[model samples]
Target chain A: MVLEVRDINTSYGDVQILRDLSLKVEAGEVLCMLGRNGAGKTTALKAIMGLVRPRSGSISLDGVELTAMPAHKVPKQGIAYVPQGRRLFSELSVAENIEIGLMARGKGRDTRDRVLNLFPVLNERMKQRSGTLSGGEQQMLAMARALCLEPKVLLLDEPTEGLMPSMIAAIRDSVTELRAQGVAIILVEQRVDAVLPVADRVAFIENGRTRDTVDVETLHGDLSLVHKYVGVGH
Target chain B: MDFGPYLFLAVLEGTVTAAVLALTALGLSLVFGVMRIVNVAHGEFFMLGAVLAWWFSSMVSGSPAIGFLVAIVMAPLVVGAIAVLCERTVLKRINYDPEATIVATIGILYIIQQLALTFYGADARPVQAPVNFRVVFPWFGYSGYKLVVIAASAVLLLATWFVLTRTRFGLIMRATQFDSETAQAFAIPVDRVYAVVFAIGAMLAATAAVLIVPIQQAHYLMGGDPLLLSFIVVIIGGLGSIFGTVVAAIIIGISDGVISVFFTPTLAKILATLLVALVLVLRPQGLFGKTPR
Candidate 1:
């Protein structure tokens, strides 16, 4: 496994978010985490990224313990996260946003050129401020920024939350491309149909606990499987 | 003197004030812009710089120029180190909460001021100008050193601008300022950034103090006016806008100088305060600050 979270418990103050949640992903695999809102889907990803401290749990990447590492150091260890709301630096130019990500890993123009190739639209708007971009374009920039890290594992939190169908397709294609490149992905998404094509396995979470871990083939054979856990159907 | 010479003198004096105010207020703005915390002890940093300049210069027995040079180099470094210590020890402990930081910095202000009073005493002390010469203008004569002050301040301001816009460290700072959490996710050490920015802010204030010490005496109580004026400059310039701060400083400084020469110093202050009130009522975000999205 490239990344593993074993029976981790995470909380914010007195309110617990994740309880005994465990999951694993191998290289070249897309693990889709599905659950109702507040089912600790986001928290699980955060725990792995060290954004939220896990009260008691062991998180490791390639057998390297990451439970005690600081949040900033997580990216340096080859994990990149594309958070919800596409938090781009509003005042900065698109190029500058990409530059910041490159600065983190001590990479330069070569990496920036490569990342921009994945999102060609960003190349044109290099001098434009990110906040002024269209919603879809902003999402592209956020992903592009994360891609600058050249991460081994990518954690995406709701990449298609507010995007249109075309933008959604673009994002799905990018995820598929990343998975094909042998990058491990832990995706927290709500749309089952949108996730089905890209995901290899489904880890259904309910109330902060892993309810079931099933292959996409099993999930595809029975539509009721998603409905039973996520409480929603396409 | 006639109105022409009188106005010329006022403008010269105003330019000097604006130059110094820009450096001091820019420091405060940087701290606020990145950290999102108001440092009430900023003026104390300026006072500390002047006090340290006096101490350093006094230690040297040679030419006043040698002493001034030593103070210029050492004062800001010492002040920056102290600011780093404060950020790590006090501000970091509080997690830089906006309200709490204000109170903490206010406490810091008193502590720094009291310490200055205890060590340096209550009497105001002056440092000699490094180069004693007068510029003989057609209408009147002016201190050549004051002109040097203007040139030096401009150079410093330009250097600061270059650092903010041209360097890799600048990119990290801007990113951290934009969204610290996102910056962290990309492996930017935000805590270290905060400490460095805080130190840079204090160092700027100290540098400004050292420059002005030859003209204005270093006194325990001298921090009050610079503090008030810089606050006005920062507010009117738009809280975190560096360019706006410089522009606003020039406007306020010139007006204060002109009004003081023509009318009274008290009136100049009243006018400046009223202008701030006007700015607050008309445009709360500041002249150059962008409206919240």
Candidate 2:
């Protein structure tokens, strides 16, 4: 397995956010987690990324345990999280923004050149500050910055939450290309259509727990679980 | 009342005073800029610097030039070492609670003051200006060391400017000032940076004392006036804008020189305080400060 999260439970300020949410992904495979607005989607990602502390369960990437490390160290350990907000350093230029990812590795020009090539828009606006970028452009910048780290597993929380259909299509293409590079991805997304076509398998989450997991093709037809867990009658 | 000579004297005095104020304000501004700590005890650090410089000068066996160099060298290093100790031992425990830091630094201030009284006695220590440089160019016979002091201070200020604007160290320091978490995320080692920055600030204050001791007799309590003035300059300049501090310090320096010469020294202080109050009330964000994001 590339990454495994088992029986993970977490809370924030006395309010529980995750309960026994378990998911597994093989190397280079695309895994989609489906849920409504507050069904522990972001929390699970935060817990896995070490941004939020969990009260119970173990999270291991491949064979190495990764439950207690600080969020800043997580990227160095080969997991890069493009947080829900895509928190790029707003004051920094795009090139400087990407360079921050490789700061720990000591040199970034080569990685930067490569990431820029992946996202052509970033190449053209390398000197422009991150603040000036549009929503889609900012998302691309966040992803490009993380890619500079050359992370083994990329955890993206709602990468297409606020983007045009064209941009969403572009992101799908980018992820597909990333998969071809043998990079494993765990995509948390709201739109079924946006993620379902690309995902090999899907996990439907609700009320801070994993309600069901099935192949994406099977999940598309299994409208009964969707009605019960997602409150959507399909 | 011969206006021509008196006015030129005041201008020369103002130039000299501005240099001292510039150095003092830079240290205070640097601490507040990066740490977000007011460092209320900073003034006390200046007081300590003056006292140490005097003591070290007396200990050195040489001409007044060697004594002057000794003061300049020892004051900063001593004060900086003390600063590092305070940060590691006391401040590390407080975690930079503004109220807590303010209270804690105040405690340090009084403790240092009492110790200074015991160590150096209540009497003032005089630092002698070198004989060769003491050839005063008579500006209405008000003394020409003011002009020499002014020139020397200008060089230091320019050097500081060059280092800050031109160095990679300044880039990382400025980055930390802008956002602590982001800088640390990039592995800048924030804890070490904070200590180094604090040491640099203490060194600047120590340098200010070295400059001023020759002009004004060193006293244990002399730090109070500059400390108060730095607070006003800080308000006028806003936090972290070094350029703003320099501009504001010069304005205050001129106003202060004129007011002290024409009016009483006490009245001059009152007027400066009043002006600062007016500015603070009118624009709390300070003259060059950005609104909190």
DockQ, all models: 0.83, 0.29
Model 1, span A48-129: residue lDDT tens = 8788888898999989999999989999999998988888988899989898878778888898888998999998999999
- Residue pairs clashing in model 2 are none
Question: lDDT for every model?
Answer: 0.92, 0.80
Positional deviation of residue A147's Cα in model 2 after best superposition, in angstroms: 3.2
Best by lDDT: 1
lDDT of 1 by residue, B1-293 (tens): 88899999999998999999999999999999999999999999999999999999999998999999999999999999999999999999999999999999999999999999999999999999899999998889999999999999999999999999889888888888889888888898999999999999999999999999999999998888888998898889997788999999999999988998899989999999998999999998889977766
lDDT score at residue B191, model 1, on the 0-100 scale: 95
Q: Lowest summed lDDT over 10 consecutive residues: which window, candidate 2 chain B? A: B131-140
The TM-score measured for candidate 1 stands at 0.97
Model 2: per-residue Cα lDDT over A1-234, one tens digit each:
478999999999999999998989776789888888899998898787776788999888877888876655666667777877777767667866776677644555787778888898888888897878999999999898778778788888889878999999888998988888888889998777787678988899998999888887786766666566666632
How do the predictions measure up, each by TM-score?
0.97, 0.84
